[model samples]
Target: MSAPERIPPRGVTTDEPLAGLLTHGELTVRGRIREASNAALYCTVAHEGREAACVYKPVAGERPLWDFPDGNLARREVAAYEVSEATGWGLVPPTVLREGPYGEGMVQLWIEVTTEGDTAELLALVDGEEPEPGWKAIGFADVGDDRTALLVHADDERLRRLAVLDAVINNADRKGGHLLPTAEGRLYGIDHGVTFNTENKLRTLLWGWAGEPLTPEALEVLKGLQDALGAEGALAGRLSALITGAELDATRARVAVLLETGRHPEPSGEWPAIPWPPV
Candidate 1:
């Protein structure tokens, strides 16, 4: 375990370069992200003078979840990445499911967050009747000692795309901390191991645009996703190796519903709408 190698950061929007690097680069572990429920290792990937920091979550360190009975959270993480790439949103970092030091795992480029722009403070809890302009209300949250506060998230386009993506993947845990804002003013969402469930487990704090009409950009993206998720499409083929058939079908269904309704999703009364510790 030593200091991570530093190299010029690659633009997240230019994903192909980073994807190739993560897919074929040499990996070296630096440390473990102990806060992660699973075995998430902080590492570096380097190839031909191009070096970048990244994270490696090996399958051997996976912790079983009663609901996610498949026991392959690593694959789901990669599956989420594939779906994100299809949307052309790049909400996810460049991630590849490859062999690593311990075993096969999801390797993703590390995101460096800088407080250099407006995208910095996207989520907040306010003591007001409603969220101020440029912010959207998620719901009321219990503060403490019989107190309540209005929880809200920024009304940024990046977050709007993420909300749609979360609905598509049935993300079960989209906590506030999972949103990574870069100095480039770009946003990325991580920790998708519990996503793509066959059920409506879309839990997150980004429910600000619930029931609103889907943006035209999002509609176009969904159209692309619909085509790519078909029986013999490329996206389907890529996801087949990462997720189960039922889950894939569920993903298709979600897209169809979005296209049909032309709106954002609302919470299903069956599951918790917001995750615990909302942030």
Candidate 2:
């Protein structure tokens, strides 16, 4: 897709105005998905003739509310995707970000794909244990012609380049379970709540190619991203909306470092080697 003329609504971070999804009245506790975090509720709803799986993250509150909490995560994720969009890396599209009664929320296009649900299955697959039919491997390490690739896999080098984009973004949640395999062999990445950390949380299995050279095209894309996202321009302004000043600063520093080095940073000097919730 060509660069979008407008940045997504979710790209903004203020909570004063919420996206008028659901209703003005208090959000009722819709039936929940069995596998989402307690802090969030996953439900299916009808939106414009399509079934949507939306995560309702209530603001940090005393009573349970059906809204987004910590609007920053959604904002940062949207901005991250906005920056990534210029590079044409299709790992994760910048879906909609909106505000809700309790907190800020996001709406994203869902891809139908088969997933195994955890890193152990991924490890087993790497170890030769086969999954049920139709569940193909698509992650960071799964691409390219190297055996020591990181724990993830995708069908081709394009996805691998997107994986590199994700790495530079410091995506803390690059778990095997989060990688989705579509029937077309394209891998769709998900769950970016813990990115843009200032502390350099690089915990990911995609680091299998840490020391390898980035493809020329990938390098050009990164440069493009750096150019579009000025040192203190759109990206910085956008990230400041979703993350703490410190976290945003850290993310910018990390991006700057990646642009300068053209490689993922090693988690040295007391920085954590992995991120929490590796899945």
Candidate 3:
């Protein structure tokens, strides 16, 4: 598949001004993105001479999950974005639920990241001993010939914020491919259809900072989320429209635990701690 087009700077392409356009705009499917298990299509959204590239996930295309109810994955995607925005992290790209050709679904502004070659280069090691600076090793694999390959991720603040976000939301799928780094040096996460489950199912590839103490800034963000999830808060009202009451309560409880402990969580060992195909 061809790479997605590079997105313009946020200053020139803010999602707020185009919110109405994205919700009510005319959608034309450009092509299908086969990498996703669901029916995800690349489409152009146009209204009143303005246009933007967006990924459309029709509800009919969602695969039924044994845990999560069917037909709600699209809403879950939008809920994740809502949480990200509420925290002021901007970790998730702007997403909304709207009508499309197939049916009602979630549509998110497309974010372009560095090419696969660039990602490979970032994860490559030099001298087989030290990784490129600003990267930290998390795991290793035996590549035969007595050689061991190290798994590492960028030592970036944005990624750290995302780690906390995942913890608060109970994200069940955070594959390495979900972490997209744009040319503008910003990191955005995608594919959040399996999040906010009442059961603790936080599978992810972001365990590099596991067991570390949460920074003061991260704690403040958690505090903000806790407040937003209060009974009378707007965020709580928004989430109620998407997920069950028990699930929303579980989300609040997770944030409360994080605030009380002020530490990144350790794997529970009850389930696989990491996603399949870490990268």
Q: Give the whole-model CA lDDT for all candidates, comma-separated.
A: 0.88, 0.52, 0.82
Candidate 2 per-residue lDDT, tens place, 1-279, comes to 343132222212222122223222233335554554434554443432223344554434223323223345555556555556556656663345555545656544445554433324334335344323423332323435655333333334644665676666677666666666564555556667667665455666454456556778877877666655565566556656666776656655665676678664554647545444445
Worst 10 residues of 3 by lDDT: 4-13
- Count backbone overlaps in model 3: 0
Query: Which candidate, 1 or 3, has the higher lDDT?
Result: 1
Model 3 lDDT tens row, 194-276: 99898999997677778889999999988989999999988999998888898899999999999998898988989988787
Q: Return the TM-score for candidate 2, rounded to 2 decimals.
A: 0.64
RMSD of each: 2.6, 9.2, 4.1
Query: Which residue pairs overlap in candidate 1's backbone?
Result: none
Overlapping backbone residue pairs in candidate 2 total: 11
Number of the predicted model whose lDDT against the real structure is largest: 1
C-alpha TM-scores of all predictions: 0.94, 0.64, 0.89
Q: Write the residue-wise lDDT of candidate 1 on 1-279 in tens digits.
A: 455445545346565666777888899999999888889999989875567989999999998899988639899999998899999988998888999999899998888776663343898889988999999999988889999999889999999999999999999999988988877778889999998888889999989899999999999999999999999899999999998999999999999999999999999888789998776
Worst 10 residues of 1 by lDDT: 2-11
Model 2 CA RMSD to the hidden true structure, in angstroms: 9.2
